[model samples]
Target chain A: MSSVPLPSSRPALGLIGLGAFGRLIAGPLARHFPVLAHDPTASDDSGIEGVRLTSLAEAATCPIVVLATPVAALPEVVAAIRPYLRPGVLVLDVGSVKVVPADVMRRGLPAHAAIVATHPLFGPQSAQDGLRGCRIAVCEVRGDRSRRVAAFLRSALSLDVILTTPEAHDRDAAASQGLTHLIARAMLAMEPLPTRMTTRSFDLLMQAVEMVRHDAPEVYDAIARANPYAEEVRRRFVAQATRLTTDPVQERDRAA
Target chain B: MSSVPLPSSRPALGLIGLGAFGRLIAGPLARHFPVLAHDPTASDDSGIEGVRLTSLAEAATCPIVVLATPVAALPEVVAAIRPYLRPGVLVLDVGSVKVVPADVMRRGLPAHAAIVATHPLFGPQSAQDGLRGCRIAVCEVRGDRSRRVAAFLRSALSLDVILTTPEAHDRDAAASQGLTHLIARAMLAMEPLPTRMTTRSFDLLMQAVEMVRHDAPEVYDAIARANPYAEEVRRRFVAQATRLTTDPVQERDRAA
Candidate 1:
């Protein structure tokens, strides 16, 4: 393995939650900043070079800390890191739903600590090859550190950053990610799909289904129930499907 | 285009519908046999290179006749061409749902006429690039003509021919094609999707939505409602989705 770069004046980047996503970003984050990560469930040996699996306190003390826990766990995680945060330190949480985590960060973190709530629009499946050109949504909750983070993501990781509010993110995600995972789950429940005699559309849906089929239960909860707009979006989608199957003529006429 | 191939000992391939699909297959089918096509809506002169736009009676007289009509129109179409069919002529209907068309062909067409129900899985959108590896499901209804058609599809058009029963086709299709178009329609109804913040899964869904968004109402009707199994598949899918959004933890536990 390449030796660690010469120590720079920039403070270390702390990463919490060494799950799939945390591990995905660890190497790239470690390349730029000395990454100290901690996960209660994870063993001491991460196998990823240059990453130091440290304590929660040590992980929170860095100038830039990324909380990569599930949205359900964000409240307790935020509380745990709140006391260890230094003034003006940037604290970002990578959660699927923005509003809940954004609010959690706003209420739990100190005003002096910069809070940026982000949802990396991809997971391990989508970014299997690399993170270059992947999308990430950044919602500024506390301070003006979004631009700095955006610049860092763009330059260091080559991510396409979308700067928006937590409300806007959740609202749009209701139709995008929320509807996507709902379809995936519903289709999985309706299992034993035809392996042969598949069309391009069915194949595409299968690919999308494969991406989210193994997602965590908490992740499903976050996207399906936690986001306020997701339920309504799913309702609208189901109502439209019902129309297509029930009054197909009227549905077709409207679509036409 | 190169000059039309010499007339062979084999009789002409009669196409009784000159709609988009009729036009799509005309060029490829013409390469193998003299294509005699007729559509009440189409003009006498087809823009296709070698296909002869002929009368319904003349088109039905050929040894191989393909009924490329809507599922709702199959009864009348089968009846209209019944008298003109030559003995042992191959009569096929290219409809989305198989059971209805298979029944129509069985009851309406002559006993001596060979009947096959086919569903070309790819459309103009899915087959935009080419039909070399596209899928076509062939369900034999009467007589032993599926091999004849399968050989033609495999050798002439380079299609992937899936041999199965009309019942099997409809059963699997209700979940695969029916569910697919339903999702596309529902997503389209939820319009103005965030184009900027899309994941690979969402993007794949969007591509699928794009594929079926412009499908004709008659086609949608056939796939969504006409197939006997489609309504049940759709009902189960919606029930699962409702369960997911309303009680995600319960849904997750059940799935787990």
Candidate 2:
């Protein structure tokens, strides 16, 4: 693992979203990078120290541009900033689902600018304290830039970088995260529970709730309703339940 | 909270089952009671120190009797011990579900012996070190004897006693424990995950597995197939899942 060298002169960093997750990363990253930030919802003057809140055109002046926008807003955000990106500038999107963002970047970003699509498999809750020990899946859309960004993440953030294609990332996530949140919602919907119950199982469910509870509704909606592969995983889970119920004997026999 | 008063002279205790749970309680209780144990699987010499393994006829000599057997075996065990029970002997069955055992004891036990059915709501894993702070639900069939046993558990074991009817105890168990174990098994069946791949949700699932993992096959069978109210809870859970899948928009709208 190559260490991300602290450049003698910090590279200019541009952040294009300022939601909870975007704000979380912006504060820490500004300490190392000269950051220019832009968020339509946030006032132009609103940004952390060392971060200059600027216009999309002004923010794109940086060598590294981060699309921290919501999944639904990514294509538009990418389109708005693409023309201003200089040659050799690294353009990256930190989103949950990968394939769509990767495609948007590949088609929309200027040919000169390097585009890398990645999913940091955690949220604001996990990143609220810090990003240590969390896994980040890097979908290499463009060659050397993806490796460079992954290397920077590994060395600077101490993140465990998993290299995989965007399609594979979405498919694996359909089971790992998509199915998990779905099950959690199902558990909460099953029955009304007393606030005081402290069984270990209940505690675990509460932990899952805490992980996804404060996420933007758009995140869940995108994963559940928009991710192409998620429905197949959900169908498989329901089919498993149906098999267990309808032909329990056969299920037991198959297990045996 | 009545403290368990140490008997001045050890009362003879009759134990009618010697499974893992039965053995755990029997060994400790023998130090305080002149224990007379009867289990078809164990010979007369199989009991621990201070416990006299004896025939069903000989076990009748004790004033306090405990039926520590599986739910399926409880009916036959209750019948065999009923004729031999002496008057005033407090007979309690420590089973997971209370309604059936309460009914069995009420219908089968001799009028002279008072039946006090209880569900400890915990197990060897939860209490492997000691029984302190655990919750025990006492379904009082015979008032005087039920108070005595509840008082003993509260005082001696330092347990939290929840006084409830057998019907209510079973109903709660159908949701809390039965549904918990069922969901756990479903989670386990979904993936053959390596221990190294543990997430918070997977760890929570493992905790559930650990709670029910040691249970006898008969225990699961009884909970899944025998508990009269459990099937209804399972059906309701499935219905809830179907509704979530079919009408998520309405559900989310209602939640909002």
Model 2, B48-74: lDDT tens digits are 876767777777657888888888888
In order of appearance, the predictions have TM-scores of 0.95, 0.84
lDDT of 2 by residue, A96-214 (tens): 78888888888888888887888877667765658887777887787477787788888888888887788888877776666566666666776564323234454555566567665
TM-score of chain A of 2: 0.89
Per-residue CA lDDT of model 1 for B73-102, tens digit only, reads 988988899889899899888899899899
lDDT by residue (A137-160, candidate 1, tens digit) is 998888788999999999989999
**Which candidate achieves the best lDDT against the true structure?**
1
Indicate the worst ten consecutive residues by lDDT in candidate 1 chain A: A1-10
Looking at model 2, the pairs that clash are none
lDDT of 1 at B202: 91
| Cα deviation of A156, candidate 2, in Å | 3.3
TM-score of chain A of each: 0.95, 0.89
